[model samples]
Target: MELSNINWMLGAACLLAGIGLGVLGYHLMNAGARNAQMLRQRLAERDRQLAELRDGVGEHFERLGSLAAALNKEVGEATSRLAVEAPHRPDLAAATATMPEPEEAATTSDDVAAPRDYADGNRGTLSEDFGLKQADGDAPQPPRY
Candidate 1:
């Protein structure tokens, strides 16, 4: 009878330990499942926002393309009208017909002033006389060595 009692007690202890471990493992698994579900929800929300942004950008580009096409059509019509009226203006015709010869109007060496000798007191000769032309003033002082 004593040996049977010992065996029964040992079996009860083992069963209780197994039940406690099972409860702990169940709690851990439930926590992990909850975290994974939250992450999945956040990912779905982000994907929806990205889709909306892509659609808005596509619409904006479409509007820009339409505006550009309208502007190009207007420009083409204006250019054609200018071309038709250009030959009727007498002033414009004369200006275009008598373009001046560049060689005949070229500047000669006499038009530009020659280089002056700075060795004498003619340092201010090339400078503009600001109408205070006091040419009979004292001679310039010599440069220091």
Candidate 2:
């Protein structure tokens, strides 16, 4: 028997339903990918922050060590000076003798360079012309651009 008109209508409806379901499935997959990308971005940001924190901690420890060494040297020097000035006080001399020499400290006062706000001269690190190169004895020229 020949197919009826109602059969074609049913086939068309089924095709439309399949297309709609495929579209929905593709959208869901894309949504999942977007969520995964967001999670990855957050993880990377967290890692960067953790790295910065670690660097900060390392710098803090370095400064702490230097400060401790300087304090130790200063105390030793003070103790020695006090012992010399007050020779009658044998206790002060004993204390000075008991203290370690300043040279024995991990770092000396001369080793730790003090922070300088001003440049040493025209070619110092903080100077504007420090890194710039030009011909010898040449005056400053205007920007090429």
**C-alpha local distance difference test of each model:** 0.83, 0.87
User: For candidate 1, lDDT tens digit of each residue in 1-145?
Assistant: 6999999999999999999999999999999999999999999999999999999999999999999999999999999988987765467877877987566456664487677554335545455653344767685769999
Extract clashing residue pairs from model 1: none
Candidate 2 matches the true fold with a TM-score of: 0.49
lDDT of 2 at 59: 100
Give candidate 2's whole-model lDDT.
0.87
**How well is each residue in 4-105 modelled by candidate 2, as lDDT tens digits?**
877988899999999999999999999999999999999999999999999999999999999999999999999999988975635787798998887646
Best by lDDT: 2
RMSD each, Å = 10.7, 18.3
lDDT of 2 at 111: 85
Candidate 2 least-lDDT 10 residues: 101-110
Off by over 4 Å in 1: 1-24, 85-109, 113-145
User: Each model's number of backbone clashes?
Assistant: 0, 0
TM-score of 1: 0.47
